[model samples]
Target: MALRPNPTLRQRRVGTELRRMREQAGLGGNQLARELGIHAAQVTQMETGKSGISVERLRTIAAACLCGNQPLIDALADMVSERGKGWWEKYRGTLSTDFLEIAELEANAHSISTWATTYVPGLQQTEDYAAAMFSRFTPSPPSHDLDARTSFRMQRKEAVRHGKTPYASFIHEAALRMQFGGPRVLADQLNHLVDDSLAGRISVRVVPFDLDTFPGGGENIMFIEGPVPELATLQMDTAMGSMYFDAQPSLTRHRDVFARLNSVALSEPESREFIRSIEYEMRGKYA
Candidate 1:
């Protein structure tokens, strides 16, 4: 069968995990090919996501690589079993690949934890708030592009809501207070946040400005937990673009960062009260 010219991020991730297993077993690509009775080039193709692997083939490779982690093995096999294109595929050519990747990651995530210092987490932003923020792009996007992005974001939010993924968001006070569209927009956005939190659909915690000795220096982090811990992905949003990290050490570091943030941030109930207070404050000011 012909190979895909550009595989989705999820497809590439399966290939990456296979490569890691091969390396951990101390077997080179040629050795792996020989063990599986395949050409070295074929092995490379599989590892680069240029080709697909069947569940049986994946099992054979995992066994040969001496990978004993049943959960990890099962996860890889499941990836191989996935069929058809996801909703994000429709925007393949229209949107940035990174944006589509984010949607795919969220769709497959077992749980999601985010840390936002400047802006409300994308999944939690209201339509008007998001539209206003997107309008600030340098050189500005064409109207259609802006509409597409905002529509895509709303779809992402719906996916998150219906997926029932456990979502924990650690937001700094500065972000909650930022009036991207104005006091009215911020008020509505905060009220929507309160409703989501009250309904037990999402967890929202706030890091107040009054706290001393805060770490992390205004970083935006989104940690996506896969079926297995080993398959977890960490995404850092920056001005340039989104950066993903999956190395054990990198995952460990971000986990620790989140833990520390959790420790200092307001508890869930307290966070709810805090948001309500802010919403009240905003309404009064705007009124």
Candidate 2:
């Protein structure tokens, strides 16, 4: 098969874990190839996700490297296993890579948790709110592109919901107050949020403005849990680009930060009531 020029996040993850395993066992790429009877360059390609690896070869490498973590190995194998194409593939060339990658990540995630200071998380946004968001793009996307993106986002939300992956989120009160698409639109969005929270569709907690300190700045932080701790990923949307973090230290630190946010945020019942209160405020002020 021809090598993939732009491998999906899952494919790259398979290679990343393999590289980590090799390093842990103190074997270089060339050394591992010598032990596995493959060319040195082939080993590098496989490790970097440019080339695919079969399940049998993956197991062989694990055995050769003395990797005793059975669960991690199985997770890696599953990542590489042949599977049906995702619904997002249709939009592969149409939408940007970040959109497809995020959908793929959430579609496969065991669970997802997100934190946002000034905007609602995409998975939880209403259709109108989503469209309004796209309208704010730097140069303002053409109508066709905007429609395509909005449609893709709605499909993504449905896919994750159909998959029934556990979802939870923390939204600062400032985001709840920030008006997007005007007061009526934001009010409708908040109402939808309240309904979802009350219906147990998602666990959303609000970080009130009165807090002494709100860590992690104002950026969006999403933590996608994998089958195992080692596969967990931390993602952030930056001005430069989307940044994905999987290093042990990075994962550990972000996990801790989320824990702190969770603790500081309101409980489920309290959060629901709080969101409802905000919705009522919006309606009273602008309805």
Candidate 3:
């Protein structure tokens, strides 16, 4: 069978670690290829997630790259053997590359933390809210494309709902009150959030608008905690595309930001009450 056109997040993450190791080893693609006794193109394919590497070969490459830690080597070997399909795979070719990548990362995350100042996080959005947001995209997407986006988004929500792992989200009060799809959609979304929050699949905390001091006040970010040896963080800038970071310092900075934001957000019960207030206000108009 022909190889799949799209790569899963785990594969891409593995590829990223390999590329980083090669760079850190002061070896270029050609040099690494020489060390591995493989063609440079083959090395490039593996590093770009277009192809897989065998465990034995991966170990050999790690040794060549001076990655001697046994745990790190073992992790790389495991990554090489990962062949499970991620939920994002079904949406391949339908959504934009950036969006698809985000979905994959979200699916693979051991834990997720998001700071949203203008809109609810994708994983927490209800179907109607998602549709309204999609409808606002510039030039507007075709009906079919919009439907595909909605379906893809709903699938993403399902991953969080059913996964063994959990997700944590910090939403600015502005996002909760943004009214993306008018009162009706906003009401439903808020109610859905309340349900999800109470269910324990997601942790929803609201940052009151009056808070004068807050981390990530000016930026919206999604931080995903990847498995070890491939430890990484992916940041999405609304205007600027997505950027992937694996450097320890950078990941620490984001983690710190999330911690600070979490510290300032309302407690779980308080957040539910805050959301309930918004829903009640919306009901007055839409109910």
Candidate 4:
């Protein structure tokens, strides 16, 4: 196949994993190229995700790198064989690459866990709530694009809903009370959460503002559990844009942080009641 000028996040990640294995084996790209009877530049292209590698070639490279982990090897093989377009591909030019990449990651994840300090997790947000939040983006997005953004988010929720992907959200109480859109919209959103939690596809937990302390400085996180532990991914948003981490150490730290946050959050039933109280308060105020 011809080389790709722009690779998707998943493609880049597959190449990155291969590079890691090669580095661990203490073999240079040039040396591996010699072993595989491919030009040195071709190896660089594969490592950078500019060129696609066949499933057979991926296995050969893994063996050459002295990697013995079957699961990891199988995962990479799957990446090599992944073909065709995903639903997110339709929005490639219409939306930012970051948005498309996020949807792709969530779609492929085995399960997802999130920690939200100021906003409801995207996969659980109602349409009006999301539109309100997006409208407040720094400098504000063009008014014409607001509908597209909201629809994209609503589609993202399907990632968890369809697969029964075991989504767990740890949201701070402040997020529940932020009143995005308005009191009525926020109330609707809170009520929606209660309904979702009852449906058993999602689990919601709240960390009350009264907590003396919180984990990770209440930073936002979206940890995507892959088919295997070694393939887990952590996504963090920054002032500039979203950053993704798949390295072992980064994944380990995020997993630990999520665990601590989960420990301090309210139980499912308790969280439902907490959200219900907030909904009642909002209804009284908004009515």
Candidate 5:
């Protein structure tokens, strides 16, 4: 079968697991391919998530690799059999693949933690706020493009709100206070935040500007916890795209960073109060 070229995270994940199993068994790609009577390039493609593997083929490879663990085999089989259009497919021609990949990661993440220093995190952004933020870029986006982006964002937010996943975010006070879409929009967004907080699907905290410092102080970051423990932590960078790190030492460092940020952020109740206070200030402008 021809390779899919651009595979979804689900597909890539399955491929990653297969590769890990092969490595664990001390078998090289060429050796595995030779054993399976397939070209080495095909093995490489499957391992890299550029192609899909069938259940029977996967089982054969698993057995040859000595991956007798039934649970692991079952998981691989399940991932291969699982078929559906990813949320990102809709925006394929409109947005970059990198953007779609980020959306997919957010959708599939078991838990997500983000620290926003400049703007409201996309998942938490209100439509008007998103429109205003996008409007500020140089050259200015066309009306249709801006609307499409906004629609895409709203759809993503719904996925998070309705899905079984959990989301937590630390917003810098500056971000919450930014007058995007003017005072009316800002107030509505803050009010929406207040309401969403009450929903229990999301946890919001404010990182005070006075807080001493941290490595991520100036950077916007999103850390997503994946379903599998080994795949758990992903750090997203706008410029660098998504990076997955499973090493204990690296995970420990990022976790510590989050803990420090959490410590400095206003408690959830305090955050709501802070937001309410800001809303009050904006009301005068809108009124």
Candidate 6:
């Protein structure tokens, strides 16, 4: 098969796992290709997600390599078995691949845990709030592009809405205080957050500002649990762009960070009350 120029993150991750397997088996790309009776370039293609691999092929490779991690093998086989594009596919050309990758990440997640400092997590933001935040982008996007971005964000909520996926969010008090779309919009958004929390739709934990220390240096971090522990990934937003890490070390570090963050965040009931208090404060001033 010809090389694929732009495989999605998930695809690339598949290749990553395959490469890991080869390395674990103590086989170089050329060596594995020889063992599998294929060209070294094909092995490279599979490892880079430039070419697709079937579940059978995956199992074959695993068997050839004497992989004993059946759980991980099964998990990866199941991933390649997935047949269709998710809702995010429709926005392929209109938005950056990062946006689509995030949606895909959430859609397939067994659970989501995130720390938000500058703004509400995208999965929890109201349409108006999202639009307001996006509107402030430098060299503003065209009005139509703005609408597309906002709609894409709102649609991304399906992954968490209706309790489809378990979501745990650690939001800073400062983010809750920002008036993204003016006080009225923010009040409504706060009300929505409170309602969502109380209704058992998702878990909200507030990280109060009084805390002496902050985690992740106030950067946004999203840790998505995959089908199996081996597949979990950590995503961070930086000045460069969205970056995803699935290496064991990165996942382990973020998992520890989130645990510490959770340790300081308010309990569920406390968080709801805290959110409601802000809602009331915003309402009292601007309602």
Listing every candidate in turn, what is its Cα RMSD in Å to the true structure after a full C-alpha superposition?
A: 1.4, 1.3, 2.5, 1.3, 2.9, 1.4
What is candidate 1's TM-score against the reference? 0.96
What shift in Å separates residue 7 of candidate 6 from its native position after superposition? Answer: 1.0
**TM-score per candidate, in order?**
0.96, 0.96, 0.89, 0.96, 0.85, 0.96
Clash counts per candidate, in order, are 0, 0, 0, 0, 0, 0
| Per-residue lDDT value at 119 in model 6 | 87
Runs off by more than 4 Å, candidate 6 = none
lDDT of 5: 0.81
Clashing pairs in 1: none
Residues 41-63, model 6: lDDT tens digits: 89999999999999999999998
The lDDT per prediction is: 0.91, 0.87, 0.82, 0.88, 0.81, 0.89
How many pairs of residues in model 2 come into backbone collision?
0
Task: Name the regions of candidate 3 deviating beyond 4 angstroms.
Answer: 1-9, 240-243
Clashing pairs in 5: none
**Better candidate by lDDT, 1 or 5:** 1
Candidate 3, position 186, lDDT: 96
lDDT of 3 by residue, 1-287 (tens): 23436766567767888888889899999999998888898887888787877898888888899976677678767767877666676666777777778877776677888888888988889999999998987889999999998888888888778887668889889899988989999999999989988998789899998888678536668888766624757576566566666677877877888889877889999999999999999989965
User: Residue pairs in steric clash, candidate 4?
Assistant: none
Better lDDT candidate (4, 5): 4
Which 10 residues in a row give candidate 6 its minimum summed lDDT? 157-166
- Report the C-alpha displacement of residue 134, candidate 4, in angstroms: 1.0
Deviation (Å) of 277 in candidate 2: 2.7
lDDT of candidate 1 at residue 211, scale 0 to 100: 87
lDDT of 4: 0.88
